[model samples]
Target chain A: MAVQVTQAGADTKTGVSGWSLSIAPRRGALSVVEVIVLAACIAAALTMTNRHGVDIMIRTFLWAGLALAWNIAGGYVGLISFGHAAFFGIGAYTSTILLLSYGISPGIGLFGGALLAAAAGALLTVVCARLRGPFFILSTLAAGEVTRIAALNWRSLTGGAEGLEIPAISSATDMVFATQWPYVGLVLSYMLLVFALSVWIERSRYGYYLFATRDNEDGASAIGINPGVMRVSAMALSAALTAIGGTLFVQYFLYLDPTHIISPDISFEFALICAIGGLGTASGPVFGALIIVPASELLRGWLSQSASGLYLVLYGLVVILVILYFPSGISGAIARGWAALTKKKTS
Target chain B: MGGADKKEDQLMLWVEGVSRQFNALWAVRDVSFSIEAGEIVGIIGPNGAGKSTLFNLIAAAIRPTSGDIRFLDHTITRAKPYQVSRLGLARTFQIPKPFRQLSVRENVMLSALRRHRTPHRANRLAGETMEFVGIDHLADTSVASLTVGLLKKLEVARALATEPSLLLLDEVMAGLTPPEVREMMAAIAALPSRGVTVLWVEHVMMAIMNVAQRLLVLHRGQLITQGKPAEVSKDPAVIAAYLGEKYAARS
Candidate 1:
């Protein structure tokens, strides 16, 4: 076993470690790889028709951020929340209300929304931390449903189900960009920031506590670590990050409806990405976005406005297949394959 | 127990008049004991004797119905389990509770990580502790693959990783072979030399007798006897509680 670990370590040093060095040295090679990938994506985005390409890029980047945020609590902590859309809706409504009614700068609204989402996530954590397995899932689902209903009925704040549309920014302070390239740049920057934060959290003491709590709550507590606090903190950070994505989403689309933002499907998509990419792995969210975003776009394009339900069916099928064949998701399968290959080579 | 010597050997743990009731049935009743620093006290009782419950009280895994426990000059009668652990105490479960997905080394590292914030130091300490428990060979092996004996040793290694001053071990030798039992006994006996005190609950008589400075017998939720191993082994109360006619026939 020690020999196996030594060999694995040596292999990782040469390949993954080299990659780590090229990026941010603190983040190892993965950061470098991400930067390279982002640059290539930008180059690809430039090749398409200016308007459509930029829109897709901005939306994709926002989804990537949301996926990463979901990974922190659902993946790393093994909490498997199915109600992140609650935070997304909260962020969108908070930002929209602050901007249109209070005349606050959209940037301030973004920060305000994120803080609100984080506070809500913290509140949910206190109620749901001790509930595990299916009960936790049920509790979160109920919470999301309540948030959705509240958003729909809160006519004064949310403008009810008809939704609210932001007028043209008419100013730089609104965080509004003039062209598609600027929007893409803004979204990509936020994506990278969220990605970096997720990686940092995963390597920290709190991350270890989250992982330990997931592995053995009693054992974690026996070591004087408070699993409840760790889990709540993770969830709060995750929700805050997701809210940032939500704020950007509203800005890019210029609209916020409770149904659009707080849809159960959005939450399911976040879970699907984590499941398909490999929960609890640093690279899983990136890999998940790479597959899910393009596939979803293609599915929608093929369905061609008439068959939206078909896209849903396809998504459901993909989720089922991924769960059935690779319970640990794509990264887990890849890790296993790599291990087998390494063993075969050594033998 | 003279005044000065008693002061020098002041009790590290004091359990006084602790009891727990489930309706009319008393699971434990007025059980009290004191343990001083550097003591290796053995708790032995037949199944359902509430020996495990007593350990739970000291570890604060469960709250007593009534009574107080003072540890290190503070009353920790209602302290949470994790809080109890933070106050320089650690314990192993009767059934080894190795973290299933973690490697043996990683399992130990998790506890060490709590003590040492830096990963490098925690990893090094984990390796050393694993080697000490004689399971260093299985360091990288996922805990799911370990044998029962190796798992028990891993549990001990994990407890040791906390750098605890007081250690509680429950039935660590429950299913080990004779040689494995001896190996465990030697490792436990060596603990005090490294400044760790042990309170072990064991059904294995020989292993307990070999390592314990004093033997404590629990019967029906009360301390039946406690003394030097040789003296306690012959006490009529202990004999009545544990041996009965079998002891007379053997003698």
Candidate 2:
């Protein structure tokens, strides 16, 4: 068992001294690889984002941000909530409702929505505090169902589940813009914002508490780490970010419905991207979104006339293979490969 | 009782009438004990003797079926686990659970940072703790590559990093070579000078007998014997339950 670890995995400079994964705190130092990845993200956003692929690009970036948010609770804190769409719905409805009802700008509504979603996240965390494993997952799913049902029934607030369409009067104050690049720019900024936050968390003393809590809740608690508070805060933080994505999503689509916004599938998609790219690392969600969004979109575009479910079938097949074989996802595989390469270079 | 519970010089940990039931079986029944500020106490029993469960009850990992537990004047039977920790209590698992991906230092730093906010201070504390446990050189090594002896050292370091007033060690000397066990025994013996109180649960009789100032023997969830190692070893009930009569005579 010990021999396998030395032979296989390491992050940086795995020679005589030993190997350490770059994803570690490293006292918050940015490695050469991290800088390049961030620069590439910026460069891709600037040049490749155009009129045609903008929708896919925008969605991908937004989903990336959302996934990073979800990773805090799902990966780091180990809550494994399957009902994050409720938070997404809260963001969408908060912004859209305020905009439509009181003429409040989506700008202020964004904060309002995020705060509300965070509160909801805190509530769910408290409710699920005693639950573990599948029970906790089910509690979250049930919470989503409750949110969806409530939204559907609350006609005056949510338009009786038929959804509300944003008025076509586009203005700068309304968060409305002319082109898809601006939207791309908006989502790209969110992606970077979430990525930075993830980095901050990884480096923070609090992040250590989170990591310790997840791996050994018993050990952590015995040493003065509060699992309950950590779980609650992680949920709130994750929900706030996901809510921001929801606000952006509604702004882009100009429409909202209870079903699509609060669906279990939306929640699954957010978590799946992180799971696919890498569950715990900050970069995982970005890689996951970058790959999953484009592949699915291009496939859908190409296979549109062929069959309705064909593209999704192929997409599902790819996800299954990644999950089955590379359980750590794309980002982890890259780290291991990098370690191996460095080891080979030295030898 | 409450006044004594709050006395600064009385005892570091006080457990009164603590019992834990799972389904129908009484895993731990009517167990009660107290330890002072700087004493090394050992808890020994056969398998399924509820030693780990008692540790869990003390740490608030699981609530007791009934009874009160006090640490540092705080009622911890219903307290959160981290809350128990914040009062300066730490423990180790019988089965060592090192975070596989993290470096050994990172594992220790997780506990060290409880009181030290900055990474520099935490790292320094982790280094000192590792050295104290005699694994400072392996600080940067991944936990995945550690040998069982080194893993036990890391576990000790991890708990010690918290700078707890009271430390509970579960089977630290289990499955170790005789030399490795001796080295760990030296570390355990030295903890009292650093202002630590210990409740060590061990199956390795010789190691505990050498290091512990006092021993508490448990059988079927009840503490069967309590005294110095020599006296407890000679008790007929202790011998009947654990050490056979011939081994008892030999001792």
Candidate 3:
């Protein structure tokens, strides 16, 4: 319940003496900690020389961005969609197809992919508007599976199971980079953009409406907030952002395989990261990505030849523990710890 | 009813033969009533009297089976809840439904957002609304920490934040202590002065009788009696169905 007025100069119109923005402040140390973590991420991306290490950094940033995007629907709006991979696949395939078939630059193609994914998201939300809780979740999973099957069989459009590859010619317009640093930079920018958008949504009037709908739909509708419109818009916005992340992923990997792109595992990973970091908070998914991605990558790298799926078992265990013990995730734990510390000091 | 001639003097709410059935049973049947602007109207009934169902029908939370409901000049019988709410009508639940995760101020701000469209302006109005409802001191506190009485006040604060011309209050003083009930009565009594026409559904006879300008009594999903509180209290049908004979003798 700690309310922070948006930074002193952020708005001149917030003239109420005691009223707060209701956006919980990071308190004293959490803000500093976040800044340090962000700085370390940038430093690792720019200064790391090892190709393996840089690859992990790139994945971390990309997944973080994707998780933040998913957090809009899953965390803020309580949609809990497991079908987000459809949007991601749509984005990746759209951009890749535009480039391979139409000779379009991925830079411009990304927008087309995002738009299509957003429409799909909106459609999914509208179709499943009446479904709540587990039913809604199952519908999203079914949608993802349907998208995967369609991509696998539709040989004319999606290139079928053979997948598509952007030739590694290293063109700037095509988003094929010679070095890994640019991709890292690109994804870091994407993460920052999603993070900024999440914060804005959390503070805006629309954000309040969205939160109200999630917390109590009947109460919200009783006060003129349309839950249907809120859910649809949140899902669409989340899908569009996630699609952008997908496009970036394809651009960096230079490959798009239906099995991999639209995999339920990828969708689960996005939700898992958000759950690990903090679902609704803007910075939760960022922290989840930064921590979980590198840890998983290093674990996989170590256990690759000796025990291939051992890392997966360990990853699942950690996720289970975090979910069971820290239901609110890492950011929530930090906020709680911060509150306890301040209370002790005052008393 | 020369309704077109006195457009400015139109009723705040008009319910005509509205009925709602669930499964095999009728929750409300053939109910009709109208409230003029700036009047405090009370609806009282025993358990299962369809008072809450009536509120839900008017608020468009549920559709009526066979009748039309008008708020101001708009037909809201088939309207969505948000549409009805947007057209100067707001209703509170019988059991308080505060956003459990939000602060009291934030809960009010959700309703305030409907009018202000900016969190900054909404926050200002929400603050005033909370103060008006005497819960400003609990603004930043979580709704989870509130008592039943405070939760009810928070509900009122939230509804008031919407700046509704007509407010539907459902059992605002149900679980309150005597002093808390008095405080709530005072707060609700002040609402009509601000140009809000209230349709209050309550089991608390003392509070409703003291405050409401008129009373509508329901029995078995039908309006059994409608008149001033003193007259309704003395009605033979109302006395036999609801208030016991001893209460009738006392009144």
DockQ, each predicted model: 0.36, 0.41, 0.46
Model 2 regions lying over 4 Å from their true place:
A1-29, B1-10, B15-33, B46-54, B62-69, B75-78, B144-149, B219-225, B235-237, B240-251
- The reply for model 1, stretches above 4 Å from the true place, is A1-53, A305-308, B1-9, B244-251
DockQ of 1: 0.36
**A244, model 1: CA deviation in Å?**
1.0
lDDT of 1: 0.78
Top candidate on DockQ is 3
State each model's CA lDDT, in order.
0.78, 0.83, 0.85
Candidate 3 lDDT over residue span A214-253, tens digit each:
8789988889888999999999999999899889999998
Candidate 2 CAPRI assessment class: acceptable
Better of 2 and 3 by DockQ: 3
Q: What is the Cα-based TM-score of model 1?
A: 0.91
Error of 1 at A143 (Å): 0.7
What's chain A's TM-score in each predicted model? 0.87, 0.91, 0.91
The CAPRI quality class of candidate 1 comes to acceptable
Residue A237, model 1, lDDT: 87
User: What's the best-to-worst order under DockQ?
Assistant: 3, 2, 1
Q: Show pairs that collide, candidate 3.
A: none
lDDT of 3 at B149: 82
